[model samples]
Target: MLRSFTKYLFAPALALAATATTLVVAAAPADAAVVSVRVKGSLAARTGAANWFGKTRTIKNKQKVTVTCRVSGQYLRGNVRKTAQWDRTLIGDYISHAYVSGNPKLPVCAPPAPAPVAAVPMGPTGTMTNEQFLAAAIGPAQQSQRDTKVPASVTLAQAILESGWGRSSLSANDNNFFGMKCFNNAPGSYAAGCKSYSTQECTAQGACTTTVATFRTYRGSVDSFRDHGANLKSLSRYAAAFNYTNNPNQFIAEVHKGGYATDPQYTTKVVNLMAKYNLYQYDLKV
Candidate 1:
């Protein structure tokens, strides 16, 4: 009976050993498959992690690419607050997570060391004094006011703020004082031609983004002033903006309320500029 019990003990031991082996096998995790998805927008595949050097190649929207892995990368903010997580392609290239939105389960190989936030540039503003800007624009503003029902003070203020006192490339080169878009969304509408440029606009929610836009060009500064009047006159919906032409302050406020610009403080800016520069004097000429 003792011998029989020992034989049975070995059988039980073997069974326990097999069960332990199975548990061990189950505990060991399997390697995950590399993730791939169709990335949206014109995502640039770069030679390295940073975009400061530019892209090696642009990946088309909705194009398929294997996301071999992920790494922390530079802060690339655009239409969306882009993630600093960089996706590694099958070809060992990198793309910003901003343009590629897909799997959350993708492996992160390292913690992201985000680049330092860049200062929003003071592009075309502050290059000249208010006096300088007024000197350059007062003539055009007065002429446009005389020709069109638009107020001279309001026009000058808008030109100063919009064109950054003629420091903006559009105003300096294309002579687009109002930042008027190109006709038919392409160039060749006016005498001087047009230019396709990148435009940044503020949304209602206060989110700012960039988009490619074409703007009308002019033969000269006076022509730009003439077009401003025509553009306002042509827009039937903006007729209410012309109602208070005798009152430059009132006119700017009305135009702002009528959606002349996306900026919420447009009326205030124009009004303040007028006061600061004593631009109201021009309105009296009308």
Candidate 2:
């Protein structure tokens, strides 16, 4: 009777182990099939899912690539399809699925954790003298000039004029020395956010109007100055100003003509400030 009881206990344990193995096998997913697809056109394979990542390589038109998986990223309208999906090549590079010739279903990539917001450096504190303001602005202006081809002299002079030598509420509060408006409060890479302020706008004909406007906010004065240069460079109207980068006077004139400010004497005011301060010394010689 003792021998019979032992056999029954062992039989149940063996049966349970066999049942658990079958359940584990059934729960496992099938391996994703790798697919070879032709690129519809010249495509850049980036290091990550987004175009903001540095390029790893260029995939030429009709080049075949083996894609192992897909992930969502920056939206793109390509010749084949408009999508935000990006494909992961077997070699670990990412290319937009929009550029791939055919729709290929693949396993979704595991999403990465959200990135941290960059810490913005603090700017100068309290009221500053003209000399102090110039001292603070010179470095950022020259850097902006080198990056955007906008004259440092023009940038410095505009800051002085627009921000009232860093005394304006916009400058002191938001660090927006250039009075840059957030048209529709649209998102921008450089802007921290938007704020509302009462402002005066004038027409070329000297017709002035007072109204409330939305303006871009920055983390500090450096970002404000940098965004000013980038903003000017991005607009088609200011395209002519880039050509005169070596000439601050001509550059400011073109900028004024592009309707940067509604003030009729905007160019003259900036030019006068440039000459008075001799700010041209900071401009990069192109």
Q: Highest TM-score, which number?
A: 2
TM-score of each: 0.52, 0.57
Candidate 1 global TM-score: 0.52
lDDT of 1 by residue, 1-286 (tens): 9999866744653453231110000111125536655644455678777676557777666666766567877775433234576767778788666544433456666544899975422222235675776776666666667678788788888888888888888887877778887767564434477678888887777677888877887767667777777777677767887777777788788777767787877888989998998888877455
Q: After superposition, how far is residue 17 of candidate 1 from its true place, in Å?
A: 99
Model 1 clashing residue pairs (backbone)? none
Candidate 2 per-residue lDDT over residues 131-245, each given as its tens digit: 8888888888877888898988999899988899899999989889999999878737788999999999997689999999999988888888889999999999999998888
How large an RMSD does model 2 have? Answer: 18.3
**Candidate 2: 10-residue stretch with minimal lDDT:** 19-28
- Error in Å for residue 139 of model 1: 1.8
Worst 10 residues of 1 by lDDT: 19-28
Q: Which segments of candidate 2 are over 4 A away from where they belong?
A: 1-126
